[model samples]
Target: MKCKLVDVFTKQKMSGNGLTIFYDYDVLSQNKMLSLTQEMRQFESIFVSEVLSKSSVRAKIFTVEEELDFAGHPIIGLAGHLHEESGDVNPRTWQIVLNKKSVKVKTKKSGDYFYASMAQGKPEFISILSENDKHAVLRALNLTSENLADYPLEVISTGLPYLIVPIISGIEKARILLPNFEDLLANFGAKFVYIIDIGNFEGRTWDNLGAVEDIATGSAAGPTAAYLTKHQLASVNKPIIISQGRFLGRDSEIEAYVEAKDNVITNIWISGDVAKVANIDFV
Candidate 1:
């Protein structure tokens, strides 16, 4: 099978989150998908058994660890790739439906790059620990309670769970998180530290907590957007652009919009920027 590899979010190659898209994986098994993800050696890889439906596209996404219910970067990247090959010239809207959920991506042609927007569904904000436990979460990240933004800590989900850290508004101060490893993996049931989100504009995060540092974390960003929007800290209809992979020099940018009303997240969108880099044939 021939797989299309793309980077989601950044126009430059290798800067954004890496996504491997395989066409027609209806015959592939979960175990096969896991192996393929391992082989690709990227943060996340996606496979679509089919594409282009009336409302959306059905697909599956995989990381080195497990098959996620949904993922952000892969979905956006998939849309970008589809936007190119969809054979629908002057296409305005596209949707990619995964086994877990679905997202709608819209695009417009710029001078050289295409501007794409993905509509993430209503967020599911669940499971909040007490204030003490929340404080412990900061400790897990090697920071103090003073590091977080005002109010109680929140565990928010758009399609996944993330412990949102609102810290000092600069990446320089946000890059010092080290996991207690077990607590982060076993206790919180999440593997990403999303912050570097200071005031309203910037975001910094560390992925692959107990392992390698992820240059860009798309899955983590979804939950982050939800958390920020839920607390009345962030508003809907405003563009929230976060920078990831900067610490690693990949310098990826994840652009998303919030749709919140009355202290609730109605919808979220994470856009993808794909410029085809390499084409390869697998034997």
Candidate 2:
């Protein structure tokens, strides 16, 4: 199998979320894919099983533990790579079909990297945690009541669900302690928690999946943008610039926008830069 290692949401190499794109991945069985993902141990590994069209392909996303219905950075990175191979004719939209739904991605090449933008589904507001549950989450994050803001802790989903946590003090004060990890996971009703520093655009996310921390999460960014827009915290027309992976030493930036018609947010789009790191072939 041929694998291409690419970093998403960063212009520089080794500074963003890493993804392994397996070419002709559909040839492997599900169990084989799972085993290979575990062996690779990247944040997320993607299998490009079939190139359905010039601008579309069938792709599957998997973490080390299990296969995911959808993921953000992997989609963006794969879209960028596909865009690169698509000869410099005219810009076209690319579609990636998952088991449940298909996402459309548009890419524009600029100098060295391709800026990939993915259109996420409409936002689904799930639930807001209670005060007690919220407090428990604060403890899990190694934060206190003082660190919290007046904003509501929301469970939002663009494709994948995430607990969008607003940090009052900022991301610098936000930390994830392993001891309280499971409690937070259960309280949020999701495996991932995306903590956004309301003051700055900085953010960090921890997932209960095999991968603990993500450098830049596109899936979470869509919900984060929706959360900010729904709360009137950020403007829909203006892009929300989110910084992540600073704590992990891989600084990345993700730009998100919520498209609105009349008075409602109809669509969400997240765009980021992608850098190819390496290409390897396994015999």
Candidate 3:
């Protein structure tokens, strides 16, 4: 199979997160996709089939460990891949029906960079974290309660659940060994903890959870935006601009806008810029 590997969320080579694309997926199988993702060993990979219907783009996103319902970088990178295969992807708005659920994605190309957006499913404010649990999370980041901003440490999800903590400054402030990482995991029932530094750098993040750092997180961003809107931490019912991944120097950006009625959030959407990389051929 011929596959194109492209980076998402940046304008230049090797800047954004990388996702490999297989334009022809007739040869695709769930087993093969999983095996190939293991072989590629990238953070994530994708396979895109020709759109059979007007409403859906046939595609699958795979991580090294498992399959994902929908992912940010893959859709952005795959949409750019399709734009090159087709022409002027102008409705630019499209939806991908994955096995998990269907999500909407849209893209626009300017010069070498392509900007894309995806509609995150309804936000789920799963739980409000406890003070000790919050302290454990703070211990992981080596920050005391005083260092973080004054906000409730909340768990939210548009797709994947994450513990979103509001912190004060850069990764320097957010990066430290988690004294009770395992306990936090056991107590919270979450795989990832995302500490978002909302004000200083717009949307810059300093993540040390999941035993590793994550480059791009679209689903997590959606619910966090909703939480911010609901708490009046950011302007409600308006698009919130967040710039992430700069602390790691990949300089990626994810912009999320929320639609809220009264105090309830109705919808959340995320947008970012991407770039196309060379296609790869595997024997």
Model 2 alpha-carbon miss at residue 219, Å: 0.3
Compared to the true structure, candidate 3 yields what TM-score?
A: 0.85
Candidate 1 — which residues are off by over 4 angstroms? 52-55, 169-192, 204-209, 261-264
Please tell me which model should have the higher lDDT, number 2 or number 3: 2
Q: Write the per-residue lDDT of candidate 2 for residues 151-190, one digit (tens) a residue.
A: 9888899888888889778466666765647555765666
Which pairs of residues collide in candidate 3?
140-178, 203-243
Give the alpha carbon lDDT tens digit for every residue of 72-137 in model 3: 667767766666666674647777777677777777767877777787867887888788878877
As a TM-score, model 1 comes out at 0.84
Q: Runs in model 2 with CA error above 4 Å?
A: 173-175, 178-188, 209-211
User: Where does model 3 exceed 4 Å of error?
Assistant: 23-32, 38-41, 173-183, 201-211
The sequence of per-residue lDDT tens digits that candidate 1 reaches over residues 168-272 is: 534454443454543553465554556655574456554445355666666666777777666666666787777777666777877778876775667777775
Worst 10 residues of 2 by lDDT: 205-214
The best-first sequence of candidates by lDDT reads 2, 3, 1
The Cα RMSD in angstroms, rounded to one decimal, for candidate 3 relative to the true structure is 3.0
Ranking by TM-score: 2, 3, 1
TM-score of each: 0.84, 0.93, 0.85
Q: State the C-alpha lDDT per candidate.
A: 0.68, 0.85, 0.71
